[model samples]
Target: MKDDKKTDKPLKRQETEKTQQLAEHTADSTGELMNTNHGVRINDDQNSLKAGERGSSLLEDFILREKITHFDHERIPERVVHARGSGAHGVFKAYKSMSGVTRAHFLSDESLETPVFVRFSTVAGSRGSTDLARDVRGFAVKFYTQEGNFDLVGNNMPVFFIQDAIKFPDLVHAVKPEPDNEMPQAASAHDTFWDFISLMPESAHMIMWLMSDRAIPRSYRMMEGFGVHTFRFVNAEGVSNFVKFHWKPLLGVHSVAWDEAQNISGKDPDYHRRDLWDAIESGNFPEWELGVQIVPEEDEFKFDFDLLDSTKIIPEELVPVQRIGKLTLNRNPDNFFAETEQSAFHIGHVVPGIDFTNDPLLQGRLFSYTDTQLIRLGGPNFQEIPINRPIVPVHNNQRDGYMRQTINRGKSSYNPNSLGNGYPLQAKASEGGFTSYPERIDAKKIRARSRSFFDHFSQAQLFYNSQSDPERNHMIDAFSFELGKVQSVEVRQRMLGILSLVDKGLAAAVAFALRIPVPQDPELPVNHSIPADGNLADYDPFTVDTALKASAALSMANTVKDTIKTRKIAFLAADGVDEKSLTTVKAALEGAGAIVEIISPRLNFILSEGDEQIPVNHSLLTAASVFYDAVYVPGGTNSVATIEAEADAVHFLNEAFKHCKAIAADLGAAQVLEATYFSKKIPSEFSDQTVLREGIVVGEDPKKLADQLILAISQHRFWEREKPRKVPA
Candidate 1:
């Protein structure tokens, strides 16, 4: 007969001997009931302490007061950087067991579902800041894995503004509105920011991203997320791979134009937050695929740029990402203050099989995240907050601080104690304990960067070259507008000099737009040289190749495309409208998870067939086409005639067309489109035009209309139309 051991399941057989033995040693035998701080056995907690007369409250009620006091003071400090944000409860599931890559429990177990809390935010904005600001969006996730809570504190942009951690404070201060007047809130379109950018050459690449469409995302659900720093994924065999984390939105990356974004800020301050909350409430959960581009340790130095630099990205074309898991956000926070506000995410938090590198910016973050929490969250016990607390039981010698929740029952609260039988001792390295990889380190304590960290202009030039023709034009316009805002001519000239280093054509274009002379050459360097405090020689910026070709990954237009599930479409109608066209179009659009709003002369119920009616979501005075992805005018002879007479409706279609948004109309609605002189000056053509050729769609068939509208929305904007309009961007 076959051996019984050979026939049994591997894990089941092994658990009978090894896992059962371990569990027996760790299990607690006694059954117990949960109690309050006073350890009272009495029930009845729905009411507070009171006197028998019911007119006066009792003072000597310890249990009631204790419970109320604890509840009242439960809130802690919010994050200083990403103060205003929204979070969702989600589950992360691995696509397949990654045993071949890392030993991380979540990654190696496809069957396991790891609970996660993800927070998305806009930097340089206060808690009351508008949602549609042109700033970097923070994409932080806290994964409550079996081993520990792992926090991936990241941003929507892959590259950062500065290279070293020491410059982080300066970068933040400069990018934020000027300290003197604080004129601009949650924006980088100020003189101080441009001045800082002109001086700091390392910020060139990031500036390209900030000025692009990535900054003004339509919704938090549409933007991509990235872990900006290089991390290490180690296996059980002690082998490690350098990885960069990326979260690709299943809805696809999309954004509004600058003008549209500004208008959205004025109309709906809580645009992104409201969109996410409503989506969750409607059961249309947002999801993203967690991907990683891992480079084997031995192949680290093979790339042209240093992996240690945070201001650069190793293009996916070079090392394509391997998507290993997916994160689905299914629930919104129960309480904004209790969950979203008090949630803490630290970059230092990591589980076994995941580790940090000596990346200078990342090293600085490890210290900064923890240090900020102490001041902002009120105390070191911030982790004790329910939202930040791990699911696993925490036991250590460290104890006693402000808001300490756990009560130690044993006599010995310290480790290496005979009284408590040395319980809660630190686990050894072999038994699922976190141990740093044995990387050798030998360096002097010098306040200097490596030679490899220099040469900041090459990537900047590469980004400019990578852009499609229209994107490059937008960059030029951004520089012109930003420099024009600078009152100081010297600052503008200095900025032109910086642009010359990036691209001569770019500098010349900006100078022309501003009606100023382009600098003949960049100013001479004040400091002759600085040396690297290492075996490697100092980097020479002059020698570095400034002619490196464009990388496609640097361009947002080159990103993944084609899903319009979360796109917003506005239906323009009024009382006594065409019920058939409105119902058919809206139903088709919303069925695909698209949002449809009926915008009319007022926010009252508009009558449909059989006295039935649909509530007008927004009035003409309240809603603008800038707030939506597309606009449609249904067949309503009287409704279209009334709306066309109003200035707001005319302005709405003009703005939508100017931004290159898709617009559809039936036979009766065509009169409104033709009468509204929104884009009258815009020259139209079949393939392309000096205005929105893709914007106007007049038809009878619903399917054809839907296909055309989706195509126009995907194009993002009709920059071709912008040229003739002479709107100065």
Candidate 2:
């Protein structure tokens, strides 16, 4: 049999040194004889050794015992957070040399190519949880550079819910299902969550993000990533600068509507994982540009909010992101268990140039990552695993741990020994060895929260104000829905107080939805992140109104909408569909890199008006509007009549209309659309502009209709259409 993976490709992906190294450890069982773990040939594999054909299996059968033992101990411990994940192999190429900023080999050389393994996951969900949960997405990338492995472990949202790592456990427990009931899985709509959030005013900024559309990203490829905590980049001359990393998707940021996301969760729980795998398998590689916001060491204290505060972000208006490199995910993992699952990423895995900052959350994660891996991967020698090993040869004094793959031949395991003649001696900084930056520190030993981290509401207000009208409305609805699910009325009322601090109008909107009165003046000490002494004066938080009112970068309305590349467009049709009308628009969309699938009343084939047997991708009963970016209907007498009468087909159109997806139809097939719930609200006009106005296109010319549909779909969604009323399906 031919190897499809080796031959099937449109782009000629260049192999890096790391890729070749991985191939050395990769095992291929093709054309090989089956054998035991000890390489013994097994002839009778199907049946275990028995006394008399049906007798009890013998314990002396090594083959059966070996197989059972391996199977029983196969699965490893999943991550406490980000358990449900999808990974891909790729390469990163720097746009230009950045010798002035740092001495990291990957960033200093423009021509150098570094192999990368990236894992995307949803936080606060179990391994079996649905991918459409409204939560933060983990965006981690491990760069196998020539020097060593550098991991950028971050998330889709730039800021986190807590400022310090000590509160990480409390935050996770609150977001998780209740301890007694475990009623809700993969959701934060519970009393425990609101009860915690109501008192933690420090989580204000991150709460705005969690409630926004960013939490429900359209797909992994369309999401943006950011290094939540600020880090330091020390140059060759030991000049340190504060930096924030960002991964900006080329396809642009987009998300599914809340209702549509719920429907998708029910229809396809593996939506994100499947989307990433299929895109790579079909050669439609996803791409993102590596951006960075660099601030000089002297400018760290220039911002109103603290740089060490993980809950706040350095707004784009204050510091612009510079696109420094391009990261392209071109290959899916060969084995999910061996590659994706075992691909360990940690923020502390930095090369020579990169170093940590004083971010408290970051400092705690530095210790937690190694500890977590020791248990999750079975031993301290987990780095020896093929997926986690660095491309360069490792020369360390440590040895003899569980799952250790290396065989040290020397007599000396300790440093500065004459037995091995110091064969693996450490090198100096001049010889490409890492050296810690000389940062002077003279501080107290007492445990106390930084006063600089107190002004949390400034950025929260900034984020709330930065949203577009539709986005802001969606946030209000989300807050209302989540709060309404809480059983404790006090928790809901207390949360309204937190929301009121961010924006009184937002609180009023949510109060209207929940049929609860807005808090006129809530009790004091809304922040519960205080010491047991209850001395509020010493740790009281003060609010700061930022100079900038809104940031365009904070809103998805400003994201890229120029291309419909890799967008899924559903073509609704059935028997007697107009061949010309369907093919004309389908071809135009496909030519622009859109994936068009035909949905009909029946599966397999649909007869066109010209008696042509067109292939149908999915049937009306099996397919869903939640899976597609837009919907289009072709003209044909029987097709329109049949679609209008079929309950499933009409319901599909209704759901598509309700979800704010672009809907287009040929004038002859307009009757099919008119049979839907939102037909009365549909505009009578037909033009390219109307596509943008109402997200509905109806015209006689197939070419014009196709053009309008393309424009409408490029917008991702017509959020303006759902402003007035929701179409009941």
Candidate 3:
């Protein structure tokens, strides 16, 4: 494989010595509790100041008063967008030095480990919202490099909802619940969102993504991240190149079904967060390959659309992403409020060798992110916050804001002061000072977008066409459902106009459900033009290029398989179970990395024939089948009889069957499988061993069945087999 992680240089131990020292002195590096902000080291924090017999509070207790006062005001404002988020600590390592491409030190070396903090969030939800909402996910990374901190504040989706930054507020307002009711707090399945989406032609591409399974990801570990807009990289030689950043999950892109996501929200509200924490705690660190698509400065305008457009992507098929470095998130936040909450990421915090582009939305984000932090963090000195502070030494002259921590020893607080021999002066370009790529501009400022951005349908068409058969069907169903909820006939019809521009067939299908006739094709400025140097049709999904077929890379079906590393499996058993068989099966599954939980009639231990007692983790009433990935039933005649008499036990099996999950059973336990839908044998043996048809594996010899069950569990779901069950897509 090519060494693709060459975009930025890494931080060496010697170069980061000062930063490491500063970090060690700060409260962030150590978890020990010492003095309060007031420098008081008085111990006992368990109880508050009280009167005789703890009947009344005392007024003379300064410690208790200060503690309560600070605690009461601890929470800062959550982000207006991306309020609900989860963050992790990681290190970024470049595959090799990328000096050939850029002068960014972090990407230019292989020996350095750049410390990183990454926060993943949903765009539309508030701080307490559910994780599985149908919305864009923010994938922002803050790298504490040798020179300074660099923030890649971006989204999971490569393309955005709109072309310009000015319309962001409008887009946000429209997508939020209707002003009158505020009915749907964090869902896109509401009227206001559909209304805005229906009218905005530019939102067509993103709509397909939001409507698709990508919106409700299975877990943050399995989703891809994109910088969203093109950025410029300038070397010391003054040569410039346009780059788009990508973070490809090593687990492969995966998402949960809409039904599963909905139920997971109710059953486990912190599903995504728990998944991440559990994975890290179990030592299964999440990893992503850092990749970048580079375009030489001269080839910037050779594409069909403007490189500055935020609502577009240079498909991997066109200019393939060169995997460069790797990012591994191994640690969870020690303190959610101090680390995850106070960590501020801004696109403007670029160090030398990396620069910006004219992408308007990016330009606006550069300002908005840092500006919002000022108010949310309570001061211009927000950078002083431990989580937000860079590892690099900050020597700016500005000082004295709210929560300021540093005590300046020198008399001079200005750069050009004779009082202290003019210390902290600006460094020249040779001393690693940042210099923007010089692209001579001589054009009049205009509110209008370039004509190159006009044809929104081509890329949407390309994406839709690029999907696999099942993926395409899911997209179609999602569009139908979202549009089906639109209360306005006009809104539904207008959206059909935009859809028609992408594919007439797709428009007609959605229109059929909305009871609206597809409107005449939307007007276009350049007759669906492709750039002279570019070929949009070359990558069309409708051709023999199909042999390269469903870019196995694009399908969630092709993700990491046969590894039950973090999969949850419920072992449904009761008293008088076959101890040897049960122990053997449980050990085998657990040894394969599956988390096994015993589900019995009661939480007490269930004793076997030889007096071997198996402690149950959950009872039938407490744990539901939906909470697990697969099911197992150990042989026990009385246990089978007991389970049959219980409604919840039967219901658990029924629900798991309806969801098309795998169920492994032996001779005695096979009676339970025969009692459910799986009693009817599947007509044909599936070539794909992972298919979960009826999910009932029977017979005395269960090793084959266990092997089959493991494979089925890895499939995530028998989505194709779902049609007969009448489960909604």
Global CA lDDT computed for model 2:
0.88
Task: Rate residue 502 of model 3 by lDDT.
Answer: 74
Superposed by TM-score, candidate 3 places the C-alpha of residue 438 at a distance from the truth, in angstroms, of: 1.3
List the global CA lDDT of all models.
0.77, 0.88, 0.76
Provide the TM-score for each candidate, comma-separated.
Answer: 0.86, 0.96, 0.87
| Candidate order, TM-score descending | 2, 3, 1
Off by over 4 Å in 2: 1-15, 684-692
Residue-wise lDDT of candidate 2 within 549-581, one digit each (tens)?
A: 899999999999999999999988889998998
Candidate with top TM-score is 2
Q: Tens digit of lDDT per residue, candidate 3, span 637-727? A: 8887777677788778777776667777766665575565544545323222223345556545456556766776777766665555652
What is the overall TM-score of model 2 with all chains considered together? 0.96
- RMSD to the true structure for each prediction, in A, is 6.9, 4.2, 5.9
**Model 3 — which ten-residue stretch has the worst lDDT?**
539-548
